[model samples]
Target: MFVSKRTFSTYRALFHENPLGLPRHKPAPTIPRAHRGLPKKMPIAGVKNVVVVASGKGGVGKSTTAVNIALAAAGLKRRVGILDADIFGPSVPKLMNLKGEPELTEKGDRLIPLTNYGVKCMSMGFLVDQDAPVVWRGLMVMKALQQLLHQVDWGQLDLLVIDMPPGTGDVQLTISQQIVVDGAVIISTPQDIALIDAVKGVNMFKKVNVPILGMVQNMSLFICPNCQHESHIFGHDGAARMAEEFNVPLLGQVPLHADICTLSDSGKPIVISQPDSPFSNYYRSITQNMLNRLQEIK
Candidate 1:
């Protein structure tokens, strides 16, 4: 479904009026008790659906896609939140234009999630100094992932989009085994190298029994802004063929647009920055398709 201009105007006005830096609320610490061993899956306290956005490798615009999806879901009036599961390289804070350490709830135990563009967000980037490197071993990463998954006060959200770290490693396994993921969306470019890794991601999720919602082919094409000519910089229909071979749906293809990158780097993702643009429409359509798939699964 396309977002109407009136709706965009309303959203823009609401965002400008509300602003960021929401007041923190006091609440009792709500951390769950530790289990003896990892159970099959643990559900988040208030989140109804935990949708993880993953990529086989890094630098495939996975984080960008995840941020846009979360924002798009918010634009659709769904109660949405985003969790940055990329412990080693969390990008949600920058993409959402949020920074600084999260304030503790009035109870002093629960962490309050920061808000931007009307979407609640939690990220490791907020916890540590942005310049500091996240030099941690496998076990430490797992522990951090556990806390990020269960500790944040996400409130009551219809959907919590998790920006997972690239690859199918300990973090992925821990999340799939410990947290109850409703489904996962794979992001990849329309290149053979990226698709190879994307396949590994698909296989990894399948092994853990996580439902693959679909695949998003990002950077599929580049259009000259001035000339308005379209070019398939990366091979076209690669993701489509891969989807058919894997029996997964091709959610949508996002063209390579300079505005998408510039706006994202400036901390105003294209979805919210240029809601009326064709690029924004592509993201909205992809989000709608994912929502439809979710409904079907339910």
Candidate 2:
């Protein structure tokens, strides 16, 4: 007697049709699933407007811009808060020089955001160990994000600046799908590689119906600390050209400066550290342009 081996796919094929060329009924076609409409957007309780600072790629000064812009708005006497939505790589904690777990509200329901330099802030960095890696899957990440968004008590804020993780990924999608995002500010360096990703970032917001507030050209130029000479180390006019092509405003260009980096690492962003410095003025200008765009959209 002869024996034969058959795999799962072969077994499936045998049941679906006759191998001996005998007539058999065809298998039913799969009906396409209906598309679920967009999720209902819920507004954060005390936030008047939600602005997310995003970038197509990482290392383009997005987190720095988010912190400084929020600080700049606060400097203008508007209540502002910064939410580090970058679950895997939270930067606000180090940038804001804040640590320790958040305390519960009086009702013992929500976590109170940490405050420093007159701006409220919340980040995953505050909850976990500084060196521990977030080696979890997507589902686990989403759950963590939900708690951060809804369980933080920010009191009253004129603006809630969300520092989103770089690229168009799960966290970005969840935030856009779940919340009423007032607008998005895209950040990019004046380099072709970075600008390519920045374009995608702008398009992603447009597809989700989030207004494109403007783009910030970070590291547009590097100024020598010793000598007052400007260098376009990352290429010149890349983001400016892209902005015109996309028809979005060019908020401002921030030069690559040593003080900006050192101050941010020390939890003293340039806006507050050197308010009179030209670098500080760059951030303030960007903040003003962002506010104007928000008003126009409204």
Candidate 3:
């Protein structure tokens, strides 16, 4: 194409204005030096100690263990509450058989946690419909997590168990950086696959300076109900070895039992449904170990 003299002159003028035909570079924004410090960890009001139950991946009975642990703690005559931190898949409502949105406190500044079976509970599941999905980005999730962490009236509990979402991601880091967690209970099946992820979770807590209370091995054994035979379903002592390797205590092992699943699904955890049952006893033992670990941390 041929350009007219006027058009060629215009192009020349544009080139002179910006030889590269690109906008001039501007300095990147900087944060104030004083504001660059890491955020201070805040303690949850009315909560004496906070313990997070976490896993490396999903499908590891982490929530089940958490619920039973809270119930067991309550059974031991200590005030206990559980917070379901899995905003995307909150299971505390179903596990605790709680429903409806939480009521705001008299000051209208905090949410009142729901109570059941002598244990208080809170979760995003209670705030939204059970069947609905939490389709939110990272910012929204972090905001909701902040609300759950600090804006709840727990009413002076001895222990607050947080059910962390699976994986090492934004929510995990945010929780670690925001609150002063007393300890963490890493849950996993007795499988290399699961233990690998559990290792990551352990490292994450360590990096954040949260004390690792110990590890719990779920589905460690499957007793044949009919034959009275014991079987190592996933593998034997996987978590125990992991605990030894990591130099953390091996809290306890929870056998794989159909009743545990059925009872939990029915909104009646084993500890509450069958308090004297062996499964309940396992959870009670784990809770005791956790309490001991927390005491040591203190």
Predictions in order: lDDT = 0.83, 0.84, 0.84
| Cα error of candidate 2 at position 204, Å | 0.5
Model 1 TM-score is: 0.87
RMSD of each: 9.6, 14.6, 14.8
User: Runs in model 1 with CA error above 4 Å?
Assistant: 1-38
TM-score of 2: 0.88
Clashes counted in candidate 1 amount to 1
lDDT of 2 by residue, 30-89 (tens): 212338566677788899999999997999999999999999999989999999999889
Which residue pairs clash in candidate 2? none
TM-score of each: 0.87, 0.88, 0.87
Which parts of model 2 are misplaced by more than 4 Å?
Answer: 1-36
Worst 10 residues of 1 by lDDT: 1-10
Give the candidate number with the greatest lDDT.
2
Model 1 residue 230 distance off true place after TM-score fit, in angstroms: 1.3
What lDDT tens digits, residue by residue, belong to model 1 across residues 1-298? 2221121122223322221112223221222445655565779889989999999899999999999999999999999999998887889989999987776554433457889999999987887778878787665565556667766778899999999998888789888888889899999999999999999999999999999999999999988888878999888878888999999989999999889999999999999999999999999999999999998988
**Per-residue alpha-carbon lDDT of candidate 3 for residues 209-294, written as tens digits (9 for 90 to 100):** 99999999999999776775899979889999999999999999999888899999999999999999998999999999999989
- Identify the superior model by lDDT, candidate 1 or candidate 3: 3
